[model samples]
Target: MLWDHRRRPHAFAGIRLQEFDAKAGRLVGPQKTIYHGTDLALVEGPHLYKRGEWYYLLTAEGGTGYDHAVTLARSRDIWGPFETHPQKHILTSKDHPLAALQRAGHGDIVDTPDGKTYLVHLTGRPTTQHRRCVLGRETAIQEAYWGDDDWLYVKNGPVPSLRVEVPGTRDDTQYWAEQRYTFDAALHHDFQWLRTPDTDRIFNVAGGKLVLTGRESIGSWFEQALVARRQAHFSLDAETVIDFSPSDERQFAGLTAYYCRYNFFYLTVSGTETGKRELLLMRSEASHPHGNLEMPFDEPVQLPDQGKVKLALTIRGKELQFYYAMEGQELTQIGKVYDASIISDECGGHANHGSFTGAFIGMAASDCNGAEAKARFDCFVYRPVQHYTDRYEV
Candidate 1:
């Protein structure tokens, strides 16, 4: 059974079950409402398990906010008049705002061959005063035990731990190493494009460059040529060299620190009315609804229309700055510092429950006109700065 949010008013997220016909590859029976979490609204992520004589129904509740939790109910029969857990919520980080791992819930239990039980759940790591999650939701595991009381509980009760005692070697080289990418037969596993599966329409790897054909606006619902990689560290540096020639302001190719359509800072190369190619800065603030757009620079910085331009970003905690360089010139700072914290969950979405994804920094190209201008990126580099504190050489 699963909760359906669409069945509102009459059945707000009603957990319903139906039989599936594997041969037909479809649901083949009449669905029936199995449970309604009246007390704890917005219940979802249901998992059913049986051990000995008891059948357990596990669920996530209280929305996907700071108050999210994992609840348990059980009965002897599959069709249950299930009794709720004594504590109701078996796991959560809701009450512990200061906890390193927060928004803990949506979990499932698994048993090892040696007879140990473990619970795997979703969690978030929030940073800054606004409690925004720049790295999005992460998975956490905790040891669990079936008690003499016939109830399952996370070890040390409910709150999630920062680290778990698990058998595995942490790959430090993969975690901290710098990534230098040049596209070939396939897009690197580290990078991903938004919305579409038809990649050839937007980008391709050829002539030792990742060529991005201009699409609609940066945040267009239809499509956009914006490819990005996740931001895993609190501080890091990103650089890319692009060769693009835009005929007008509408045709643009650049680098951006993006969270969502509502929050981002972009640095693009395009043409101005004075018939000159220049670097422009565009930022979208996390406003009430759509967002508020702003141009930081008083005047556009002109660039030669002939060669490759290197764009760079250095993000240290909440501070973000952009840098640029011409073919033979040294990289120099261009824009003022921005509040990089805005590229976080708190500011990424219009509503509290909407921001589930993390921040990203990447390359993009767009053209409002029908013309599909091409932006060829020579290379893209992601270098992690190893430091406990935000301070480090960039």
Candidate 2:
């Protein structure tokens, strides 16, 4: 069984449960609607597990926000009218507003050999007061208890905890918070071209630099020379060194906080009408159809004559600060801080468009003048203030 959404009445509307059967080596069945959440506006992340003679259906209800939660239903048959849990929500962060983790739900259960049960779920740790989760959703584990009535419950009061006691050795030092891409030969595995653009045609890796050919503007959906990685943290510093001199205003390249082609915050470097090199900070607020607008976040500033320039973005809490530096000059702040939430999936109406992916910060190049401009990014570095890891006990 699976859950799918329809965007007719609204974005992320009518999340209906559907069933499919797998035979032999292939999945062969039509989507048959089994359940439609009557009380919830958005229901998703359905997982069915069989325990003994009863079949348990776990579902993630509500939008993926503070109200996100996990609900349970059970039945004897594989497909039938199941009974909802008496408590409604088996696990959630709604009741505990001040908890370290919020937006808790979408979980899976696993039992260890020693009869210990644990549930691994997604959760979000938001900033103080603002309630915006810059780290996005992350994995959290909680112990589970099976009662005599055959009902399962989260053991830790159904709320996400900052610390959970696990019966095993945990070495947090094994995880690294920094990721550096030298582009020595090819793009790193973490780097991916936005959308389904032809990677071989639009990008080339040689001479210890990743070269991106300008195709469409940053706001165009068809083809844009943009490569990005997920934010994955509330506080992080992303820096990229690029060697590009734009010949005209149409050709530009810079660091970008990209949600989509229409919804993005870009600090682009380009040439003015008088052939003077300048840096421009802009935001693209685009919706479906013709509801699109591009606004300048800061006035264009002239750049010093340098062979290579380093662009950096510092994201902390809800603000994003951009910086630039020449090859040897100290990094200088560019413009005022902009709202980092503008690049979030919630603000960009990702649910309305049925896109569940999170935000991405990356490098982009554009040449709307059809000049076939190229931008070379020598290296890219992403250093998170905190490291995240998942652990399991044998």
Candidate 3:
């Protein structure tokens, strides 16, 4: 808490107090150094709340990793010296690595009409043992109450509880309901494509089907025909029917379990150089340099002259498998079971907490031929399967 030039190690990593310019409709002016904590190291995300005579200053520190926590400070005056909480951190999962919800911090407090205090914070669910956050960070709430000493605290203290009761209604039926999209009139709300303002050049919805005009390769960071939704469950099923005719090996259109260019499993309806239609499986991992694709099947499955193929993927915890079916036949498992953990936060683009995004299930089309062939998808279904958080049988 000292203000000596020799005491601070880093530049521009502390919490500051700024003023809002009402006339300019923006925040302006010089910043004031109210709290520069060297003990907690990486301090950021400050929120101020006033209750009675105490001014509470909450900050998220410890680098948003396993050691992430919520540090609270308070003072009678708005600008003088603030004392840290008795326990320092008011909400955290740092010590409880095995907890169902992990990486708890960067939170805000709320009060309800029932006169109860609650804190909503960020959380994550990692796969067992490997500790990969497959779902990235999620939101969680905890019951809180004012302490006798005038400090705010989480209900049970630092470690966040698995479940907390809040003043709200939760409908399980509607929460876990299946969503089916036909793409009849226009693009559905759940679907999103790559970053590009010129969407009309990549995809369009016509004749009750979502059509993708093959553009850049699927590994493209910009302007790729990849439409997808967030993978939000630990166990789930995703199915889509696509009719794509790739003239050569340079073209591909089908389903993909994607994380980034370097981490994904794509099952596509591609063609050989001689123009023979077939099914191909491509795998890429973090270890692969330059984002190269690994063709798994020595002999790709030959497809019939008909065009429609149903592509699907099922994710159970850390395992992912792909399936395919013809027009009137049942779905059949096609490729080998993949380590779904690879398409997660830890294994996404870099190792050691570099990436912090979840996976996505989507349809993609790539054409290096410059022909802009069309790939039509009629329906997509997302069905979530509830399961125990722990690696155990229900």
Candidate 4:
């Protein structure tokens, strides 16, 4: 089952799960949201199940504030305007003794082969200043059993530990990794990511490797001209070899970590006044208020006679390292190790609020005086540590 959060019309909403035919690999139908609109806040969790002739849909209600709860809806058919309990709020802050003080929401439900059900929901950790959060929400398990009316409920309310047997077999611990995609094939904007993308600054997908033309410098508030996916906790290394001829001293082309319009890190190569390639690092914060800092290369890196160079970025946790290679040899490190946490929400800052997708690695080129600079990315690669025991199993 898949659960999605809908946020439209100025209020928190509910979750929706689609039921599909496993064999045909197509969506047969979907289970609609049981509780919706401002009444439920944001219903983010939806786990579906079939018990005898009845179908149960479990979800979390209330906002991410202090009054979140787990609720249930039931229907005879997989798809329905489900019937919510008259009491409405099933699990809430009042339900748990260990809830501390903040809200609890965004849960996952899992069922074992032995017909046991458990709910895994996220809860906030309180701090002195306020309820500042990382992705540090903890998961709690609750014992669930079918009631007299054929609905499911936690046995003794929201306990810290449900004490239910783990549903699946044990496996060795594995680390999560980032998945990288190259726009080498037909270029289309239909690909799925963690969030919707800005369409104006990104283009070109015909041959291989996506070509992004930078519109403004990295410090611009609304027109950086870079498109990227969101970066989660997983570490990633993105490398792309770009070929571009600098028409003027102001032309630049390279790779960047684009969090949003105002928060981004870029390592680019531009033509110098003296006709040499200069590698530089530029960054911005808070809608580009501080302008940009340029760390210049000690010596200009010579590009291929065709004026092409390869740029790459390696991101591990909160650090982003940049490197440039010419003729297949690492020639320069563009800048000091960038502390990525500074621009992330975890660091108590906001720049790229609307760009919540995963970290993206693509090429960008920019020119002055309306002169178009074409960059060809020979290849792009992303390598991440292995994190899944059986990726296909899920």
Cα error, residue 342 of model 1, in Å, equals 1.4
Candidate 2, residues 1-84, lDDT tens digits: the string is 232355544443422344545545555555444444436546667778889999887888777777788877787876646777
After TM-score superposition, what is the CA distance of residue 288 in candidate 2 from its true location, in Å? 12
TM-score of 2: 0.84
- Computed on alpha carbons, the lDDT of every model, listed in order, comes to 0.83, 0.74, 0.82, 0.56
lDDT of 4 by residue, 129-246 (tens): 3332222344666666667887766656543342445656765443243444666675434232212266534446657666655455544444444544434333567777777666
Instruction: Give all TM-scores, in the order shown.
Output: 0.92, 0.84, 0.92, 0.58
lDDT of 1 by residue, 1-394 (tens): 3534566553346567677899999997687766676476777888888878888989988766788888898888767778889888889988888887788889999888888889999888787777877777778899899899899988885888877776567657777889898876677888888887899889998988899999987767678899999998888899999999898888888999998776899899888765579998889977657878888899789998789999999987878899999978899999899888888876776335557678999999998886999999988999887645442212
List residue ranges in candidate 4 displaced over 4 A. Answer: 1-104, 108-114, 118-184, 187-201, 206-209, 213-233, 273-275, 287-307, 347-358, 386-394
Query: If ranked by lDDT, best first, what sequence of candidates would result?
Result: 1, 3, 2, 4
Pairs that collide in candidate 3 are: none
Task: Give the C-alpha miss distance for residue 118 in model 2, angstroms.
Answer: 1.6
TM-score of 3: 0.92
Poorest stretch of ten by lDDT in candidate 2: 385-394
Native-referenced Cα lDDT, model 2:
0.74
Q: Which pairs clash in the backbone of model 1?
A: none
Any runs in candidate 1 off by more than 4 Å, and if so which? 1-11, 21-30, 390-394
